[model samples]
Target chain A: MSHRDPLTPFLSVDAARVRRNVERVQAAADARGVALRPHVKTHKVPQLARLQVEAGEVGITVATLGEAETFVAAGLDDVLVAYPVLLDEAGLRRAAALAERARLVVGVDAVEGVRRAAPLAGRVAISIEVDSGHHRTGVAPGEAGAVAAAAADAGIEVAGVFTFPGHSYAPGAGPDAAAAELAALDAAADAARARGVEVPVRSGGSTPSLAASLAAPRVPDELRPGVYLFGDAQQWELGRTGPDDVALTCVASVVSTVGGRVVLDAGSKALGADRAAYATGFGRLLDHPDARIVQLSEHHAVVELGDAPLPRVGERLRVVPNHVCAAVNLADELWIDGEPVPVAARGRNA
Target chain B: MSHRDPLTPFLSVDAARVRRNVERVQAAADARGVALRPHVKTHKVPQLARLQVEAGEVGITVATLGEAETFVAAGLDDVLVAYPVLLDEAGLRRAAALAERARLVVGVDAVEGVRRAAPLAGRVAISIEVDSGHHRTGVAPGEAGAVAAAAADAGIEVAGVFTFPGHSYAPGAGPDAAAAELAALDAAADAARARGVEVPVRSGGSTPSLAASLAAPRVPDELRPGVYLFGDAQQWELGRTGPDDVALTCVASVVSTVGGRVVLDAGSKALGADRAAYATGFGRLLDHPDARIVQLSEHHAVVELGDAPLPRVGERLRVVPNHVCAAVNLADELWIDGEPVPVAARGRNA
Candidate 1:
């Protein structure tokens, strides 16, 4: 029933918790003797990516050319874009620009994608995407060697193979999906080795599959997990992390009470409309455990309470959004432990 | 299929179309002798609000204290917050400051809300909200008189009654819903008049209901319509508008082609994630009518095109987002007739 400040509905990141999670993930990779290339798609914060690098991460992963440019401008080298990029003329020019400053690695899963990225083939390294089980965008695992061979034929250096284990985020499917991802990567690596090409790195790991995938015998040389740095409702539900591990939270205020529903200042704009398939509500109210975000709009979230009284107007509370990645992408800056911290790469979504 | 601009994901609004829509609505209101208090919530731009005023609007309607403050700072003289506002200390102080320069009207739907506004009553005019079947906010029609009487007792002048026929947005529902809204407002106005309170203005109407409601029997003194200025997918689906009337559109480039799915550079951040229950897809592509936005992320919208074949990676397309209000809220500047116009009141989401 109290607000420390009136400016509610903003992004707040617990710096201590973020630092701890970053270090813990690095330690996990250290134990496995696999290099950690934490994905910047989660926080999109150059400061956090730098912390990971300082904590012994070998490199950082990005999803877009804009994101890679942002991190490279911030003086971070060794950036890999995990997404299967389809570069236009502008995108090709951007990739070459990034290659001038950092060790840029671009992902390609198709023959046409390689042709599109031909302009930067000599300048940047290319990685083949192996469709493990997600069936989203990557080429089949058996096709990886062919894709890699094609890229090599196009004058692009095929550095390694990578798969997303996107099914790992599915409910009760993390471990099995991680196992499948490792198996696919192993098959692709074997195929590449048979073709007299060295698959220097085989990367595959999501936050939910990080622990189990890293423990697998064939986890390759590097692991890429994004959301482990900022635990979300899905992470908590999947048992991949605990409440204390969550780094970012939406600081919102109770705005109005019409009938039984109490509306909050934060809505899809601040918290994001990313309700996990298995999540219970739109978000979790840390201040009121019994409160559930029933509905959300661009600027309003209606919270419903069960056997608990609603918070008064002007009362600020912390909300753990369903998906941390999307929520962080919407904000321009974040409060690091109640202290405003600039998110330098917030708007570089594309 | 060509975007000469470097920015891939952007929204463009035709200034001439906006002017036409503004003038059309103003003329419609003038013919009915109803004051046009256009809602600025849909497009939080002071310049656009000024356009409404210049087109002979009686005032401007807002949705939050932050918006009121923003418009007031930009020299808008009359503003009405259509939502039932909770006047907390900070909100009251802001309202007091805004009242110093502009005519401020705050909505109240409950006795408690009126009591909360008592401190700021001296500086604001209160309008009691009646539930006109929107069921989102406001009290029932029978309960409006008591709330209006309470506001009078608290020294807050009951300017009149207002309601939103939100149900009017549904197919085949606009006329009846608008009629119901007028009936509710009529009953509430009569009740307030019986209580010896001067009910000078009775307001109700959304975009779908505006045209019919203006012609309805016992039309209110003022009309507040937000989305008419920027026709979106919702308007098109409801048969209230045509594609040519869509002034705002998000321009994005085709980023990738995987099997039948084509990924675009724009996503929730640019097009917004607002979808109505009856909406077919996230948005409609202006050039590629066969493509549909199947899935959306923070930075990418997965568009699927069937047999028509997707556009090339470098090709650009314009997308009419499902909801224009939320999409407008996400941008800092809007492209008006292909020119980037600064949105003076953008990001005042509170």
Candidate 2:
């Protein structure tokens, strides 16, 4: 690949590093006898999805119908929208169209969600989302059976049970969050089976819980980890991945330096303003590990160089953002190696 | 405009309220005899820029060259990029091209920026950005004269002096920040005059300090307020504007309800993850004032309804985000009244 410096405040991905990450995760999942269905929400690039599929991913997972449509349009047939989608008329139409093109599996946490998705009964499979300590979007473990039954009664095919161990993102919370995810998925699956419904696919796993998933008493049949491919500062801080494992970074130029403080052109708009409670700073400068992003405006990241030399004007620095998914969503394209790849689902927030 | 409900998690603007906000701010600026140059970073729509110009704004202020280019291409001239630009090769080329289309004014905070931008000698005018306690980007008030002199020595025209009272975003800091902005601009202007340089324009003001600007000892010649046109939750919490004054809101659907907690389709990807330290919550539900967003994921905003009726599935709720500029950047289009208008400069963060 060419070594030309990319435009400042642009996203760049090391293709070799991404391939290695993909193979590493796939091998881990394979060793555990669990199918790896990488979440495309992290990169939102069809080419990366294709790479995952070629690397032995069973299918792909998405968070929005817009993302599912984008993946389906790119010829990725099997897709799961792991979100409790609000079935408005417009949403139903979009989901129905997507179901026509792929083996679309949608998540439902409430009976109303099932009733709303009844129109696409034959076309779409419904997966009951169980709360696994995240408490963001999902039903209680005991309520999953009723939701699954409701979907089945409405003539929809039951996909199975799924939960996101999102709490695993917190520092020192991965193992417990993974254990909770296993219990929740097992309880939901048992509840569905007791109601005479078949639980075909059980899915659970986040970047932080990927390894924890393998050690759980009841391992999930499939894992859907997104951010593991492009490690972030949060992942680095959590010890889930080392600095060398980070594949994607925002290449930014030092725009201004005054009062011993350096400012990069990358800001919330480039690195995203997602600061986990455990995150040390907004982002970490790859070249200068000692530097910390003290402040972020819409277009500037103020860096406090503790002991590292201050970056000169126009000098580019790679920054590993606090959250990779949010960072990727903000980018229009990814500079893979030296080639520009469109972030097809960049703003696909439906 | 049609009366159909838009897709969930989409940005919607009230045309009437935007017009009212424009007139309100315009009247305020006119009363103080200060030219209003609305910062387009808030809305990023050319149509809104035209509305501001039609409402008596002398010109428009932008935060990036991409934004300046967007406005200039839309036929609106006299653009001021209120940023201490790095002036890298690509940046200089872009600035030169924008200067050909409009009266381009760029900000410089150091001699390096002035030297890098000297290539645009006759085409671009440079404004020395003075630090008014923000400490984000800008030279000290006393140092602005040297930067202005350096720019003049390089054959670039000196436009004037400007500072952003960004510290005013905090609660109870408006009056003090406004006074500081005025003092900084005044000091910079005096320094420039003493250096035998003409300071033609003196610009300062943010949304929080718009009202305080009028009462400052030395009122600025121009006011550049961005978020005033679309009030947010931070503005509401800071008592700058009431809930009724908010012109923009994200229309989201109640996707799930479990364990007395309701979840909306709007998440960080929709509402933007910009919770100011002094802000109340991620966002405020306009229809249900008692409802507060407790947590946000990539695709779900968990709301804790306090004594308010829980919304059912498929119900749409308007959310006033904590920061309007960050929220607008995440959206691809704005549903104005009932029609969709593309956020022309949505990801123009070059």
Candidate 3:
């Protein structure tokens, strides 16, 4: 904490810890001969993306075109939107304009998505999304051929295939989810190649699946893990990262202590109300590990102090949020050991 | 819904519905002889606050000094920060500066809060918060006298007492919470009056407890309800508001329909991830009333269409979030009938 008022909730990132985490993931990917394209959606800051790139990341992955524009404006040229984009006419124009400044790659899961993206064929590259086991966004492995063929037929370059092993976020589901991810990527690549389209890039991996991704027999060409740089309580609960690995923490003050419960100034507005199924509480108090955020309002996090000594009003505490990506998105700036760094891509949801 | 890209998730507010809701609440408060002080934390826009004030609201309630500064700068004079403020030297200086421009009122639950606020005694008015079964922030009703005496002893004017019946958010808890709130406020006022302090402002109420508050025998002198302006999924589930009463919705387009699941571009980043314990889902799709958001990622909302036709890729839909306050806070601007209104106090979570 700096000399600033501790009563206000602010996000603090340990730059050294983030650098170490970046280097650790990069080293693991390097040993596997895979490109580590860290997702900037977690931090959403150009400086952190530059650090990851400097530490040996091939490129950066983003969730929205606005993020791509933000990073591109920050001078990071190579960017991949790892989301299936269904752009309107205006969006197509924006995407085309963004492509002029950077090597933009967009993801497609359906043929309609590819057809809608046809206007940016020569300017933008397309990656076919294959659903491994998350059952969220990607198409089936067998359907990847059709989507890639459609993109290729529309003069769009079929760059590669990508899948998110999001199910690995659950406790004890990492290995199976990673195996499924690798199998799906391989199947999609094989299908695309069978259709006479080259599948150069194979991207898959999340924070929990990083080790499994590195240990897989069929390794991906690149990994897209977002939350590794700033581990959250969800990752910690999933046994992917230890408490020390968490880089970002919300610094909040105990605003009220009534009925043996502590109310923190940081609520959903600061920590983000993201609770994974496997996560126990809204967030964990770093100083008092026994404290659990039992309830969250817009401006108050009601914490059950349990057997821990009651935190006095105005005492500052650090909280590890359940989801760092959501929490980081809520913050306007990140404090790096007292230095405030603006979250350049904070509200770039579009 | 405008010429802009439909695929980008954006918040849309129904101006007509907002106006109706404001008038409705104002009428109810007016009939009950209580001043309506709508919490600006819900819709942190100066324009909306102006509408609220124009609709018979006595003043506006904010959660932070930053928000007070924002509203004051916008020329809305009467502002009350409803949270227990613990200010440092810089914070005190900021408070004094803000008090110069507006009739600022700060809440205090502990003696330390009052003591810290004593430096700005003449400039800022202090309110003692009372715990009315929602053990989130306030001191006990019996202890209100000591807190008021301390604030008065420190040369701070004891304005009134306030309590947030936040527990009323749950189903079937509204009446009991409202009764507790009225009883606590009455007890606190009596205690303060016995301490020779005038407790004129008796502020309390949440969206769920609106009816209960109006029906209570010992009604509060003022009401401060935030979420009634924009009903959410949680409110609907709690039977507090009907679907038509919801004024705000997240307009998102279906980007992927894989494995029979519809994935919208709006995820936790747009609709917010605040899920109450009794809530059914992350959010409910307005078009498909039965559809529930099964999972949420940074930019993907996986919706499970239960017996409803699966939303096609590129199809636009409106989603009612589980918590509107959290959702609105995530957005940079709110689209009011195709007009973009900047959320002036979006991240003023100081």
Candidate 4:
């Protein structure tokens, strides 16, 4: 351990924890006869995505064309860029090139996207993104018909109707958000069907709402939960996953013990600056769950010793980030069993 | 311009703005007869650091030893690692190697760090970190003497003392935070002097508090302000800088227009998720400051059109992140005059 104690403030993936999480999600998806297309945005490592696929996922879901390109280059053919990608000439060109070697399905919420993607209409496909109460992106459930019609009008393949239950991220909103996704997917499918689109694919799921949504009599044909691969503090606090399910942890060394404040080297840069309103702290101490990361600076995470023993300076601690997706995006690579694996799609915001 | 329209969600630094910012901070530091040791963590671009050095910064400040190594390897001779690095064997080894290459000064706030760096007792020097009002890292102003004495006890070089007025990053707290920094630095210097430490370097300054702290009769011997190079929304809102002073912007494409919500590809991943209590939104649109970034997901930033005209899908907008330091840490590179400059020490959170 001394020889391999990586320079403090690094991300490490527990392979066992990862396998447990993958199995848990895959088991749920398999039982319900739903196709699993786990979002790769949570753990951007190609190896992790491949693990999920081997564990029974149909394909993989990504957030951007750059991410899709990464996965495709890594040899994953089927990808759903599940964001309303506003395809400009560059985007269209990139999509066209990607389509040459893989099965790609972009996402669209407005007619403008369909128009912009007209150049690659036949080669590439698009899924209608429904709002489903997240209100962050995607059109409302009823508005899905117009977007689907525009895709058909543009001669683009309407792959399906998909929505992200992002509202599930809120405190105690899992069941409600799941209900929203269920209703939204159902309405969107019917609306697209009414528009004479086959509506062959209906996809919806976010880690927080996936479990609750699965309890419904009929779930979406496809699921795209991202963070189930590495449970985050938000998911753990929201009752979506337990502590044992968290696969990733930021290994941080205690750098300061000023006035009893146990400060860790893993600050915002390492754990990410995501303190959702409901999040107990900036992040959670994996070993000492009682401790709270009260503040995060550029390179210091100040903790409050809440029944947890104050960590001595130079002692290492494992931290669980609030939003694993955002946190993982900050790292260049992640350590798995003492070996490093590049975050293949990290910094793919473009 | 057409050829240079980068893919959505990337960081870009304007050369002119950067020059103006450097000149602005440098001019003030010169007037006060203080040294400029600009923190490079905000930009993390080697070229920009060189630009600042050419403009007359005495040295560069980094958050980690790895960052110091980057700048040192890039030909920087002087560096001050501004974080209280809790050095283990690996950390000590890295510090010793860096000290041999550059005039490096690591920060220390606790006796434990002094003990850990005992092996590098003669090769490296350390500055006592003083807690002004931020109370993040560092010892309280009065404890500086005890910590400095420990370094002396360990037969290590005690350079001086420094503090970050992080509390200045708040609504209408700039002046008070600066005042607190001034008093803290003064007390720390006196404390160190009492402990028979020379305290030649009395460093204290954050971007928000730099100007106000300069108003004191006598400023510290050195100023270490990072964000002044790239004005963020937080600084602009605090009246520390104007819009023109902002050198960095996240170039993001409007990807969705669901109902009235204008969603950009610059979500938490691109623009960063640091919305301080005082910040108006997740981030500010550089061109359309009237628009509010109401919400941020992993890959989507939802904006409310507040007097600002709605951006069309596929149209790109420049956004000023609320915290430039956190935002820059997420990007792999930054565009400078249509050329990509790698974030030299990005992800060097250690």
Candidate 5:
């Protein structure tokens, strides 16, 4: 208690673990003869993206225009926004400016989305999104041709076709999701070719489905695996990553301990309350495997001491969030090797 | 598409509505013969807290040391941190420094918590917390005297007791939770008094149980109701707040609209993915009453078009988040009166 623990409940990233994770995934992508375009949405840091670039990554995928701007501002030359952006006039202007500085490709799920970005025709390219079992976004595989044709007509280059295998998040669902991704990408490319559009690039990947995506009958030309950078409780429970692969943890202080109840300062605000149906608790303690975080208020996490000794008040614990992306989104900075690194693109969800 | 909607997804707050809500709650507290010490956890803005002060609030309540530091740095004088802070030497030094500038009261539930803050015994006072059915934090009512005696022996002034009736959030549990809160406060105070401690200040509140906390057999000396400043969908659905009372909204654009499927740019990151067992959707559209958000990804929300007409791509809609606190915590600034006001205390979760 005399010595400070840098500030309780901050995000602590293991630099060595992150570097190993990057090398491991990059090597896998290289062996598959596919270009690794790591998604910066997982760790929104420019320095981490540089590590990916050094590992031979072709480009980076982002979820929002803000992320694209953040990386490009940090001197990255290529970015792919893998979400259909229905831009207003201001956004179009920002996209136009960003496209001038970097090679930018925006995802489009419908002809309407393609027409909306018509103003940035020559400056930016459009990638038609196809539904590959995720069903959260993207149009049907057969509908990709119409959107691709629409982008061509709007004077925007039909850069490629892509899909997000979101369903691969469940346990034992990766291989099937990867197969669906490949089949959808192939069908989408064929449809675009039928419409007199040249589909050269095929992009697909999610953390859980990355390995299977490469080993499928037809590997995609590019992959966008985000959560692989720092495995979370979901990936651990789903058997997507080994024990040593989780590179980040929320360092929290035990604020209250009475009988079986152990409370931590990292609550829903720190660890995030995005629980999977298969997850056993709200979050997992990295050091104590048996302890279960049963509940979360804004500033408190109630831990059920399962076979683990009850920690004294003021003791610190390393917590791995249910979803790392959600947890990182809440913090303003990251603590890497005891030094604070700004989450440069934090609160840039738009 | 031609006219810009500021930004696709951003937090928008109605200043007039927030003012009315402040006056309304302050009036209620006044009539109940209690000093309003509004919790700043909901809307972490000093200006809103200033509105409460102008409405006759005696002091302000916060949940964390970071929040207390934020409000105090913003020129707030009297601050009460309503959570037990297990401080290290650095935090103790900070608390001591803060106590010198402001009349600070920190909550203590365990004897260890009192000992940890004993360095600021003369400058800072300690408030004993009692468990009032929220089982989240606090000790039992009978245990208050032991903690109070420890604080009294540590040369710290005892600031009486407090309880948060979090169970009042359920549909019909307001009255019962309020009754439990009042009873716990009385019992905890009596126990402290028996230990030769002057138990003068009794604090109890939560937005849902504010009215019942006043009308119960006994009224608390102070009320610390948060979330009443900005009504959310949970408050609306639970019958705690009127439709017109909601002051904040997240303005989002329809990113994709194809046949029966419509997607908005506001996803779990913008609106947050905290869903109670009783909540119907991730959030509710203010303009469309029947639409339900079926799923939320990082930057995309899938909407089920229920009797409402499909909003075209680029169309903007005002959305009321399920929980206002979680939503506000995600944004960098608030668009109030068509101007940007920085959420200065954003990411002060430590």
Candidate 6:
């Protein structure tokens, strides 16, 4: 150890803990005959992405073209951008560059989107994003085949389908949501098959729903979960994972103790203001789970400890954010087991 | 410009607008006979900090040692950390390093804090943080003298006092709350003077309170406002600034538009989820202010244009985040005008 305090408000990813999560999720997928294609958005570290590949993941799923580029630059051969990507001239150029390095896959939902991506038809593969009840993006599951057919008509190779089971993060919804997600993927796959298109890869899974959903019979061909590697307050509240499963935490120092409240140095800037609908507090205190973050600002988090005593001014405590993905995006680097490690692919937001 | 679709989730700082705000706030401080030391936490961009310094400001204020280190590395001299920092060995060491480049000033509230900072007493200057009715951090106004006296006894040079008029950020409470902040700062100054302390600097002012408190004569010797440089949704809601005054905006692409709603490529990952207490929606759409951000997932923002029509998919829009500071913290680089510039001090979370 350098004997120096690691960055105060940065996420510390325990490499060993992250490896355990990868194995746990990989085993779950293997047990159900599904391929695990872990989402690279959570860690956004190319090292972790490589570790997933080393751990026998099917491939990698990214949330942005920037992420795909980062992974491709790190020698990853196959990557899927699960977002509804609009291929403007710049996107097409990036896709062209990415095609040279890896088998780049882009997701689209509309006919215009297919037409927009026509320029990259031969350069990159396309996936139709299906809306499996999350209602955020993607075409309806029944309409997935139509979009896929349009992409095929545009000389683009349709590489199966994908959906984000975002609602699975809600409390009491993971298993059912995952089951619904799988069913929707099946429906989309059936639609594609009806058109004589072979749907090779079916992807969907969030951290909260990964275990429950990936365990179902007839699991999809691939799972793209991002937050499982960093179990946050939402995962803890939903009982998807135990406190010990969390691999990443925000270390903050006590900055204030006034009026029975202890304030932390890390606030929205560090922990992010991503409050899970199921979570009560802003974040869970690793050292004191009973404490509640009653108030948060850009630079200060006012913690209200009920029966539990708060930490002293000089004390440092680890904080598990309510939403791991947002928390990871807030930080520039990660402390690997309390050691600051640069997130090489961080800020690659395209 | 690289013509890469503006990097889907990058923040763009409008130089013209930010310069206008800098001049406006500087004039407000000058009218009140207070030195402007705008807090650099909101933008975290060294260029903006330098702009403020050039705008006849006394110094810059930061909330973290990481921020101080970043500014110091950028050749900024006088910097005050507004938060009551805990002086761990790491903090003391970083402070010592910063003291070599800049006049690092830290906030102290208690005797233990003073003692903790005793190691770096000869290296850095100290500022007693006084509570101005926010009930967050800092000691009582009357206790400022005691803390300053303790720091002075511990061989630390006291540089007067500072307080965050956080309550002034509350909507509709600007003038009265700013009055309260001035009164608290005045009381602390009086206490310091009575205790035989010089009490040269009395720092106070927030974005919402700046127009009111900073314009009031004899409010304080120094003014520190962070969010004004990058006016956010909170500033718009608090009636502190107009849309034209907003300098920073998260420029995101419309990834998907289905069912009369548009899904933005930027989610909490880009805009951040720091919804101010009175934020009307998840964020403010510069082009479509009426568009309600119905939901925000990890990597997607769902904007529901119920009765109002929204832009089509692939259309780019500027989004004013609820809190600019938190949003800046999430991003690693910024698109100024049309160029992607590294926010050199972006990830200094320590």
After superposition, which runs of candidate 2 have C-alpha atoms over 4 Å from their true positions?
A1-5, B1-5
In model 4, what are the clashing residue pairs, if there are any? none
If you superpose only chain B onto the true chain B, what TM-score does each candidate give?
Answer: 0.94, 0.97, 0.97, 0.96, 0.96, 0.95
lDDT on C-alpha atoms for all candidate structures? 0.80, 0.88, 0.87, 0.85, 0.86, 0.80
- Chain A TM-score values for every predicted structure, listed in order: 0.94, 0.97, 0.96, 0.96, 0.97, 0.95
lDDT of 6 by residue, B260-293 (tens): 5688888877877766656777888876667667
Task: Kindly report the docking quality category of candidate 1.
Answer: acceptable
lDDT of 5 by residue, A49-128 (tens): 99889888998999999999999999998999999876677778779989888999999898878878898888899898
Task: Put down candidate 2 lDDT per residue, B55-144, tens digits, no spaces.
Answer: 999999998888888889999999999998868777888888898889999999888888988889999999999999999988899888
In terms of TM-score, how similar is model 6 to the real structure? 0.94
Model 6: colliding residue pairs: none
TM-score of 1: 0.91
Candidate 4 Cα misplacement greater than 4 A, ranges: A1-3, B1-3
Tens-place lDDT digits, model 4, residues A289-323:
78778998878888886887776787888999988
Q: What is the TM-score of chain B in candidate 2?
A: 0.97
Residue-wise C-alpha lDDT for candidate 3, range B170-223, written one tens digit per residue: 889988999989999999988888887878899998889998889877688998
DockQ of each: 0.38, 0.62, 0.64, 0.73, 0.58, 0.60
Interface RMSD of each: 3.7, 2.7, 2.6, 2.1, 2.3, 2.1
What share of the reference contacts survives in each candidate? 0.26, 0.70, 0.80, 0.91, 0.57, 0.69
Better of 5 and 6 by TM-score: 5
lDDT of 4 at B212: 83
Maximum-DockQ candidate: 4
**Model 1 error, position B89 (Å):** 3.0
